[model samples]
Target chain A: MTETPTSSHFKENAHAALHDAPLQKALQHVRVNFIDKRAKAVARLPEFEALRDSARDIKDHTLANLDLYIEAYEARVVAAGGHVHYAMTAKDGVDIVLKLCHERGAKAVTKGKSMIAEEMGLNAALEAAGIDPIETDLGEYIIQLRGEAPSHIIAPAVHLNKEQVEADFRRVHRDLPSDRDLSQPVQLLTEARGILRDKFLSADIGVTGANFLIAETGTSIIVTNEGNGDLTQILPKVHIVLASLEKIVPTLEDASQLLRVLARSATGQDMSVYTTLSTGPRRPGDPDGPEEYHVILIDNGRSSMLGGDFEDMLRCIRCGACMNHCPIYHAVGGHAYGSVYPGPMGAVLTPSLIGVEEGGQLPNASTFCGRCEAVCPVRIPLPNMMRHWREREFERHLSPKAMRYGIGFWAFFAKRPTLYRLSTNVAMRALHWLGRAKGRFASLPFAGGWTRYRDLPAPQGATFQSQWRAKSGSVH
Target chain B: MSAREEILANIRRSLGVTGAEAPRRMAVDDRLAQARSGIIPQRGQGDQAARVATFKDEAERAQASVVEVETAADAPGEIARFLRDSNLPATLRMGDDPRLAAMPWSATALDTAHGASDGHDLNAVSAAFAAIAESGTLALVSGPDNPTTLNFLPDNHFVVVAASDIVGDYESVWRKLRGGYGKGAMPRTVNFITGPSRSADIEQTLLLGAHGPRRLHIVIVKGA
Candidate 1:
């Protein structure tokens, strides 16, 4: 969360994450579970493709009129007695939240999980302003305590194991019996509950991430497994809901439709444990809700995506289904993508948000596997989007010189098919003689990574084009 | 000069939409009805329950205990014993429920209380506002008997459920909330707790109680 791994320069971070054993294990678990669960969920729906198309069309239509929907959402929230704040950038979002926290003289804040907040680096800003932000979501709290960015979108700490948590608790709670048997799962929960309970009641400000913003009702929906979002929204005197501007849905009905795909795609569940709809602050005569509510709508480079070819990117619900189902994502994991958002979505979103200068390499991280597009509920053509990012990156001179040259060579060769076929046949015969071991090759030129993992089958003696030509009697 | 304009202008510039805006494609009124009517086709009777059982089985496999009882009265003693066995304090926080209120708790001496109150007391007893059987979730709504804070603040939290309150699906619960609630009414807080507070942040190690109740005790009592 702290570092932008997608930036062209963060190769060091990517390399580190790629090799980190525990990180690798965690990534494997997320990749496998998400892929399997999403496959099963998609299989259950007879109209999966049609539903995806509908969701995509709805999102596209809404985004095309994003400005209108945002205005309407703001009006509704204001009418519902909530104040709306627009943030043009991450800095603006942080500044607004900091100002609100300062106005309330807040020293501590209880937080609900919001990836956008993490994207904007909100916690550091609050801490710098002297407000201790308490992450109330169990996963968020764990990552916060560990002082790390979330590895996955929905399950922030999906990469972690149980024993490591025991060590962290022991380190933080020194007074507790160090020997407290925590190998059992319940014991760990008991320890965390004991600590976070005090923070929930005592924190002066509550911060949450909004899943969807319904323009019609001026309501925000937050879906979670733990009940922290409810406490984060209701317990504090001041509640600040942070969300990306693209999250706006025209109506509660649209919000529900999105939520339907959301839980099923993310966790293979009919619905999350908690699907809460909060409309502004508590009304008059309401006793137990926040006295003041603030909705900070963050653009942070999103609106630029509205009408362009990449406009469909706004339709993403952050369901992470595409990333979950991507084979390349499974093998490489999120950290390899090098951004706050990662995996296939990150490959497209990171470059889109940060521009090609920093995030260009992200798009090239994909294999153009259409699995992401197939699994995406909103049916965003993620591979195509990544390709666009690649094209943009190339146009802006962000792609590496070597890759650019390689692409140029391929393009040139593709145009001269007869020469390309002749050249490739000769090259393939030479490489086969040099590399073949029985039927497979143990090593190949310019493909060390692939060869490192598994054996690469040797090339056939004749080229496919040549075989086709012979069959068609066109060789003469 | 104004906050709204400044914010909007800044966003427009950064997004590079300062000069021209995209043509509007759809309006809000066009999408209202479908958004609010979040209906999923109702599965045949008992299919939802079967799915819920699978979820419960998954939770059980992960080591949390699951039990079903007829009423709320039997909850206090079971939770007390569980806490005792776990060596946690006798003080517990209980959710507020009518069935729980119906139970005669004069027999037990531990702290009996309900809403955002100080939970320094170890053993607090309350009732679940609703039990969502679909996810094996216990809904805790903020009220006089069931304080929202009690569900989160206590180290050892006990949830009492009546088998009858169990609904088959989340959609059913939504329908109940939507169709039944009067206009302009919302609970102060509605908590749907599936498992105890858990995190797997440290080296991917799953930590059970990093922020909320470490132990979740569910008491299913006989007909209240």
Candidate 2:
């Protein structure tokens, strides 16, 4: 199992991942699938562009008036006999959940895939309190068993191949026959089911994340391919929902707008296998739902983004479509960023949520390819967001002095035409003189990172400006 | 101050946006027209029938168990027969559908029938007013009569859908809902169910019945 990566450990892990050919191949396949399928899905819909625009507008409007909708949602939930709790931070969210567990005396927790829970680090907290928090989502459970964080947003275990998974299952489930053929997806699933069935039955509490929180009804909508979320929320005595404050949509109809695009963009499916809406807790006379329901609305740095240019980032549905299409992401993958969220959306979101001090390097990983923006269902300007973070990193003095000086020197000369031309002329002549038989630089000074990966093509004789001037026979 | 008042005050202070006046006596009937207008770009002819067809096709595509019947009276017997086949018990919680309430279900009762208000009925038989075919989703509304409990509390959930209530896509469904509920209108809750309650939470293995019903059954009532 891969160890949980820390800031100090990320560089080495990234180096290893970058060099791994099989990992690269797997990522390339995923990138093609996500981009190609999304393109096809969007092509069939004549009004897709219009729909995306409307979805973006709706989310923006909803977030701007989130206070009203949250109140409306609370009123609806209360009327439906559900309880609501507002949590101001990650710790606050965890505390609310822990309190609910304490009150219910919950011994075990079955959970659906909620990134918010991951953000709060709820599993560790729950385990510390002697309550076993079991991740019910197949991908989430696999990583949880290995004691690792999810590398990708959509497919948490995207980094792992079947062989690694087989090893994980063997290590975790010792009772299984040693000779069991675990290479096939079906066999792995069968073994997992046998073990998880007991956990589901025994769990005292169920926790889930909401895709959308309908303020009008105090209800949450959870979309999943597997049934884990339903079980996580329904079977246990106490049901706790962890959601970010920005998840609120004004009405079910609004939620519908987002749902139309979510599945098509994420998996190229008309819809996921299951989309369940939960309201409060089980009402009187109901047979099987939890007796108690608690909604822990978290505001972990989300409120700070409101009414700002970066506010559009909140519209993200965590679909992973952006990362799937991004060239930079395809090359580096999720682990390189050293954060929970990876890829284009990660590059934008992690810095905002975790602060620039921790995740400042993420934004710089991008080449501003704009593929992320093209694939984003909600149409977030990812490159612009990265630029904003870059600015923030510079202001915070988080950037290296060498990088700062280099950028500063470039900017200084670029503003002066004479100096810019002089520098370009000198650089072009030097590059031309160094150009070898193959017309590529195998090794070069000042461009170590670039040269390390592949040979840099020798500069074509003169600068573009110089060539253009000469072509026009107007060189001064 | 009460929780509502305190919450409102806190929100007012935080949002820095003045709270709009609550419209008194905003009747459902008046709002429905406004809601509908906002939802549909152009009032398409045969919207209802088209919507219903959309729902039916979506249900069929998703591999959901859908059966069409002529009348609501036929629902209990058909649903009961389905449960028997699936080996699920007949004991069911009921949603507030006037037709379902009026049905002579004692004649169709596979085991027992309980209203939405009945707290003990875990295996539920309910009715969805409409479904979206594009995504194979069933939409449910919660109200005084149609309590959300009946649909959720059960281990086996059975939904009786009217074929005429089916719609083509999520956009159309949104239009119907928006048209049904005008701006600022909030239902107690609306559920869009695609399939049975499921989770892949435990080792990425897909498991049914993690928190909600292990099974979901849909019976479509046609020409009712």
Candidate 3:
């Protein structure tokens, strides 16, 4: 269940991301593209906010009754002739998938874009077991060939430009002519389509992540615009659905309520090109689809998140809206966070999934701007959760010595009003007199982190308490 | 403890409840049985003619071609015409759908094959279980009647949806499915396809025909 977390070195990753020229160029697109499209989509639907509230309520209800719902869901799946496996950890999930693949003698496995798979590190496990795993989503395919993790949740290759993709394709797709008309985005999509279509046909097993798993009918739903997920499930002999425990909803109508906001928040589409609800393996008379269906329900610390301060984070639908509207994500891209999930959602969730000790630095990577909470389709209180993680980090002594000492120093003064006022007033007067000529400080003693980037404004001579005390009731 | 039992035990522990809690079980059962529609958007609600108009408009907006025929018998001709107009091959593959089999294919000089796709056909046609006005989606169920492959494997997909089957929202389709497949049961697959296959993965530039039908032609059977 435990993987090495690079989140402890977030500062270095963020610094490197800031200086990466091509990556900075690629990160600019997220700022330009998703904001207006989502705004326009929201503007078109007047019931969007109300629907978001409804979606939130549904998820809350499901989580509160998750154990019962899981029992109901498993019963329904078995009745439909599909198998259900409960995986207590990431390794358990990998082992279940490997055993299934080994039973089928599956040489090649095609995969839809599943962040759960990424979180479990499933591809590496499959390769270790000697089965080839092929990513079928165009974005996942690009990142797989380049041997990197997804930078963004919905768009895996968001940190790369077209030239970089063209180079990767040219390097890997050596069977094609070196100088075919590969300049346009459509040309690149066409090449991936042609290549992946063969893998889809021949792969013996398929794996996908569920957008929603309906307990009412034992159905697993996947929504995609590219239709790769449908092909991955339909064209194989075995279909294995990888889902976390919180994905279960009660009924089709409940799933519909969430779907109303999902595509609109993710890519600003009214509905994706394909929204498939698959119940089980092929029916008796069915001419197409897989012969076996299995759903792997993974806990991996999510059950512990229930009824905790971070419980709200489980309401996430992975819409990518929080990241799309995130200022920090736009500045540094997703790789800077150094987690499978990134941006504001990752900041709150990474600590819950992985411990606060290793993931303590992630929640501190935010500006607390509130845009993530505002744009979230499920209205997860992301900033508040990050604040909770910060409190836990402080309580657990995971914060650095300098930060703890700085806060201790401030707390000492905060306990005594008169002493705090005297010290601040004297220091403000001294700084004002010293920097009045320049009106800003290019460098300040013991404050190089701030002064290194930009100038700090000269302090006012009077403290806020003194000014307020003198001007009380007169200005108004 | 088994993984399943242990996981459930941990969830119950964290949630502060036993699995035998009556009210919780009742809540889950009630929600599933009721299957209530939460919030239906107002954009697609209207009378029949207005609903049909909105359906066609939304389908076209999603980049699918919409054509109306007088009856089910005339659907083949329109599909054949669509193939001719698009400069695609004059051949189509389909399943053993009774509605499609009953069509008068002799009315057009087009070649047709039967039973699910093996990824070689250029054109295929199927009968939609229902058509949604809101979001312009077509609901297709998997069976011997309309194999799932016919919907995705072909380059050009022609769907024959009866005019009377168009609904105002997705909830209505759910009601229809419940009536057909019984409560708490579903077909092997229920596909809600809004448009032809597409992807914006490449630098967020929208491109059609990414591993599914490039063209979706809907032949609405009016007054059938």
Candidate 4:
């Protein structure tokens, strides 16, 4: 995790990503793989849609009574022989973790993939504190080697091909033979598995993120396709779960409702290979499990999201279906978004977490395709929240001067019907006559943004209003 | 104020609620106590035979090999034959589960080791607490009976699930947990495993056996 977010320069980053040959080639895998798998998985279960509605209701109930749930959840954790630490900010969360690591005299820590850690820059903070943080997830390990952020939430190395990973392994694992046949993906996987196994055994502290925290059972659950998260939590003497306070559900049954849709929407599996529920430290007679359990509940601006316009965004399970189906995300890839999260969900969430001024460029990244809403298991209305962000940006004058001026100009004509019709009528005929030769605008004044990428069709002699009026009687 | 109090205060403020509201507290208490289940898929419903069939089909679809045995005593020989056929090692590690301990391991020539693994073992087996047919998931709880380490550390994993323990959905397994472990008290770990470990991290080309068990073999015991 890094402290800097290049979200303000999203336009420039996108510009660079559009032309990056290797990145464009890598993004093809995402466009082809995730969407089809999720579709097939959803089609198999008739209860999938009903389960989604149930999941949404469960989250909405929990959020409304969040304070009480947190109280109950804390009581359970404390009773189950685990410690609960509350962090009001990401910095506080990092300090809490660092303190815990220092208390244990930890040198090496094996970490499962956690977006909360990515948001808080936990790895960099750990490294700065002279602790080695080893990423256990194959995708996470690959990205960590390249010193890059994850392009997709679930598929962190989706922006990389097998060749990039092969090179990274060869560069870092210098002790291995140079002529090793790392041609296939499986060979690369096997190589990383062998390397990480030793680290898993040696690491003193294991860190992971929880998909859900059940208040009734006092359990923190992780749903992973790979069993890395389980190994990370189970092996070490100290297991630390880094989670947001909003992840709590009231009961195991409620978690079941959410779990039903989680894997299908994310990886298109009936169930992920491993869905582990870790309650607390090991029992008295238990042989091989963590000796201590700790949960760092980080708020980092999510509490204020309650009862607000962006409250629905809190319902997201981070399944990554939104990005998989996004047209803009397909074109530019995740690095271009310049945030830990990418795609439509990121567009709404980044602004909330990082402030509208820095992350305002992201909300405008959507084409309003609405596939994200349709496919969302909990049914978060992403496009509407992006619209809310746009309004906030416009009101605060955080949007570009040209966009503001253009919107203002349109608003002026929009308010007065007579003037609007008159201007549109005159402008339409002029454009019709001027562009009659080519019949399209390859380049135009004040429309460079649109025409630069693709041509805008010229007006067909008359405006839509005039054409509508002429066809009104006959059509009726 | 302490961090916990401050965070709680912030949440209550945003939610426009007093922390001690009676109705809200009641609602939360009722929800937790009731622990009502939501939608459950109908595919895995019916008698034990139907559930076992659905479980096998779904498990195989997830790339886990499943075999049926008439009794718990028959599991070891079947697993040994599977190991011999697959060209795997004759040795395997496991935890000290009583059901597995009751099995006649000496009947077969397969060398069996007990206790938790330290990552050197190639293959291991554990008796599952329950199995869900909806997604072909085996629910294994953690303790000395069947240590959680045996589930993840080894390259190859064999889980012996009871046919009677196979339920139609995840909710059924939750009820069984409540019945067995008591309300609000559960094992340190309950792992629901569906297939062998796999990763699509490298260019979305899925390759099994990333970090956990490379091969997951399930043996369903029909009856006592």
Candidate 5:
């Protein structure tokens, strides 16, 4: 069913992704783009690294007293004349939104890009309940039209080319004259803008995600470059902010601290174009704003992640920087991970939210290059958390049989240094002689997983220990 | 248990807390009460002239057009000149900001309307509550005085701020906000707008004007 939900088939998904021609072409844009831009932006701000530490400490302090802060945050929200709902599960989150829509008799709802909505599968739920939910983010709108999951957290349709988007626009907007020029990305954006403008004006309910929930003033802040989140929230009669629990910050200043690093690490902008801090609803005498405001604080297993090995993940601002810097993500793209999130952050977080059984393979897919941790705004030790997940997977016997037995066999020799050295030395000598002609192995028994896509360089008849000893334990 | 109670209870259970710890409550209360502004960069710290220079420089870097005038009276003529030079319509929409209402709009042959934008305006202008020099951000608080829609719904947006209102960092803006709205309170909406709207979602090719203003023009009045 649905091809076994690709996360469980991560290896196969990655294999298929490697062979995908168009996706490969589309992924080339990501490799040379975000890395250079983020480096440039981070270079301009000398205090960027220090700001990252401050951001990290802010999240750490808030999370340590998360219960009390949440209580205080809720109190401020109520005092500001807004309503806050807590959803312990994803279904409860969806049900809460559905109830709001039903109460409002909503015929149409406009939405900003929100990973939490993706987690709750809120769009499908609303559609099943006979309410139309329209995605307003240009990237999200494209993926939504194709009925596909997002490939990247920030750039949701990053795995698509201009040609593919043109085709999608042609198929969906059949009423548009076939002769009209849709040759460029800007034209597609313009067409979407014209169509969504009416949707924004007429929608009965609007749902958006909060970049941060400021506890001091009971504010839900949204940072966007397109200004779509503002249009989605302000035009409608009702505005709903769907945020996970750990998005809370103690004060406006903490939000500001995180904002400095968030945009820099995510999109390389000193500031996103629009950072709207909305508190409560429209006040009396205020013109052109939502009348009712609601915030659904969804836990969905995040509360359970607190005080665990994966607790550092709670500090994630969802800046998508970890994925941007991940090498494995560069290879396979986000859809291959097939979780709500992808890349290094997903590798550790998916198993925590869903389960180790369903999402265990994601953590194994990493090369552990540590790029994700290096670029994280809050400095999440992503590789360390993935190692913990690997331990959990191994303890549960969820890893492959060859891996279990192979590590076990290696451990037996590893425990005895003499035997380990003897076996490795003999094996190296045999392989060096066999591969002396080509100086490499194109294929080998029990190494298909490696050599299938890349070649392996041969050793030169010496174990690493011997080379280290000969070189006096120094390496260039 | 209610969803709120159960969720909070689970968070307490996971952290091995009873939700009644005095030290935890005190820490949260103190942090909220005395909001600490951390790591304001040196780039934005300066005197009035330096602050204006940085604000103009950073605003231009973010692709916003900035112009300085001698007085609040000179802003209207400059705006009219800018619209004419850009070959835009000589019409503008604005909010009930008294500073803008007092501008000598009749000095130029421009037609301006007052009130919120209903998503059908070509250009709109609003007075900033304050401006930040760090990233050239204009803080617009929502009220009858200035609707938030005017900041986002226009094709071209013009914001007028006094030079003295320019702050060094967002922390200074927060201080001004607390001074205006009191502690633990805020207006319905506060938008920190850096530039015109943009999106790189389409194949990561950056395009200006996805849904908000395609162009943002800031007029800094020196002697207001």
Candidate 6:
């Protein structure tokens, strides 16, 4: 399964997203539900902010000593009778997983919701290998049936309404009764539950993503509200954990610290319904569990993100808080970013993973409102990292010619204080005179992007600096 | 180079360090060895009765039903009553946990089966390893005694948690786990379940019973 990035076409994607009526209706769920729920959850926990700080420090310590931790973690996994596979690239990860399935003679594979699998494009690869990869998460199952990428990380089908899901279920589950009541969301859920239950029981392999990999005990933890991940891993003969290297934490206590903030930030729950920690496969004499446990640690591009300005990006726990609070994401939704990840975190991290040339447009999509960083469980400096990407885009000339010239013109005046004040003062006065009658510009040269959407309010007679100077002189 | 070696080398290169750096190695080792607790929330910390009360309150807040019995002997009766009240079948599936086995199931008029669920069970019961008051979560460790399948496959899950095993926060549960399983050694799976399975994937309207048990009933043994 190959993923062709349209991140370079972010403008067209976002413009199309803005006008798409169904998408606009679906995105309302995100804007209305997430913010209030997060606020209530935060209000319930008085020490939430303090926990966030602890979580951040833990990630920082882990990232700094990542090599040692990885070695320690690998040893522990081996000690527990599990194998660890390292993937230097996405293809290597997929290849390793496919090989494992072949060795086990796996024909059907059930999966938990995993963003890493999405990043690796595992479903397409599995299908190509003649392995049926069935997604068990309701949102993931909907998107999988529709043959589309996830619009949001945690809420994969956040961009679809129940009507669309009802349609998808009808289209896919042709064996089910046509007259079955499929009106409410609960009806759709019940139908999917019954259908996926069969996949869970019969699948030969189960795959899931790790929220945190504990190096102390070689444990892989998954946090989920739905029990789909639990059923996915437990019901199959082989349980394969697809995780990036940065998911590692040093100990269970460190994992606990991160867990305190993760669910609250992501879904506004005190704790997700299930926070399962799996060490190896089924232990000796265990009644039920996977027979073989394999952890495929993929580094794709995260290792290069260490010890740099973007190193803080590794601190992310994939909580989706950044996107939940992002204005740009609320406006354009996840697919508009045209990367595996979206919103503020995606803007900074996608470039490093995919390449700056293709993913550079993502950084420019943000409004720099700083809400993402404010609510981040690990306190990653998302806006600052995005600014860093913008700088790199300018340095490498990846930015458009128009944007380069515009910044250069601004820099020319910005470097000279007198010229900056003079030019701004003149331009403001001229615009004030020109817009005296209407007090806004419906159309303006070189500002079509702004005017096309909404009228640009005309500038007042003088810039803020001149007004401040006049007020200060009068006061003296 | 192998993928493992190449990936580690790239990480070391990016961080501008050799893998053998002493201080870095020491930091990692020390953290793993110490396993120090950080920022325990005060909400879950209190006297024994307060902790139990907090656990019950928090669990209910997470949408799980909590019932307290005077002793372990009364657990089966309570489970039977819950089944009858909910209009569920009088059948229960469970693993061979001693605490659950010790309960006098013969006293109740319910049919019981042993071993893990095969995804067809309507009701299942298991003994919790520990309960965290901080988030009203139950910690269940997987083994021959309490099979992991009992936690997920049943339509209704009933957990019997001893009141004495209820801890203040998650960190306390880790301390208990280390005491039981030894440091740096864990069960095959340690499940921290807060409530019945749920999902808000559809239009952000929260719904319970999305794959796991539709109802989670906790019977807290107070005196035993």
Ranking by TM-score: 4, 3, 6, 5, 2, 1
Native-vs-model 1 lDDT? 0.69
TM-score of chain A of 5: 0.96
Q: Which stretches of candidate 4 lie over 4 Å from their true place?
A: A473-476
- After superposition on all CA atoms, what RMSD does each candidate show versus the true structure? 5.1, 5.4, 1.3, 1.1, 2.0, 1.4
Q: A370, model 2: CA deviation in Å?
A: 0.7
DockQ of all models, two decimals each:
0.24, 0.21, 0.85, 0.91, 0.87, 0.88
**Superposed model 1: Cα runs more than 4 Å off:** A4-6, A10-13, A37-58, A160-189, A283-287, A425-461, A474-476, B1-27, B33-39, B44-111, B121-146, B154-224
Off by over 4 Å in 6: A417-425
**Worst 10-residue lDDT window, candidate 5 chain A:** A1-10
Q: What TM-score should be assigned to candidate 2?
A: 0.82
lDDT, each prediction: 0.69, 0.72, 0.92, 0.93, 0.92, 0.93
> Candidate 4 lDDT, tens digit per residue, A1-476?
37589999999999899999999999998898999999999999998889899999999999999999999999999888999999999999999999999999999999999999999999999999999999999999999998888889999999998898899999999999999999999999999999999999999999999999999978999988888998899999999999998899999999999998999999999899999998889999998899999999999989999989999999999999999999999999998999989999999999999999999999999889899999999999999999999999999999988888988999999999999999999999999998999999999998898998999899998999999998996888
Q: What's the TM for model 4?
A: 0.99
- Give chain A TM for each model in order: 0.92, 0.94, 0.98, 0.98, 0.96, 0.97
Per-residue C-alpha lDDT of model 1 across residues A1-476, encoded as one tens digit per residue: 36545457556556676677876676667656666666776676555555566567667766755666777788778877889998877888899999998888999999998889888988888888888988877667777778877767877777677677677777778888766798865677666766777787889989999888877667788887566787687778998999998888776445646765776788775456566677767655443678898999887777666557777788889887877777656655665666788778877888777767888887777778688887787888888888888778788777778888988999999999888998999987876786555878777778887999998888777788878878889645
Candidate 2 per-residue lDDT over residues B128-184, each given as its tens digit:
857766556887765555665555446677788777777655556556655786543
Query: Model 2, range A1-476, lDDT digits (tens) per residue?
Result: 02232433445656777898767765765666667777887776666677688689778777666666676677777776778888766887788889888987888999988888888889989888899889877778888988888877877876666677888999989887899898776567667656776676678988999998876546688888766676566667788888888888766566767877888888675677667777766655444567787888888777767767688899999888988887767776777777778888888888777777777787887888788898788999999999999998898888889999989999999999999999999998789778946789988988998999899999876899988888889645
Q: List the residue pairs that clash in candidate 6.
A: none
For candidate 1 chain A, the 10 contiguous residues with the lowest summed lDDT are: A1-10
Using lDDT as the yardstick, the better of models 1 and 3 is: 3
Give me candidate 4's interface root-mean-square deviation: 0.7
Which regions in candidate 3 have their CA more than 4 angstroms from the true location? Answer: A1-3
Clashes of 1: 42
TM-score of each: 0.81, 0.82, 0.98, 0.99, 0.97, 0.98
So what's the TM-score on candidate 6? 0.98
Off by over 4 Å in 5: A1-4, A436-442, A451-458, A467-476
Could you tell which candidate, 2 or 5, scores higher by TM-score? 5
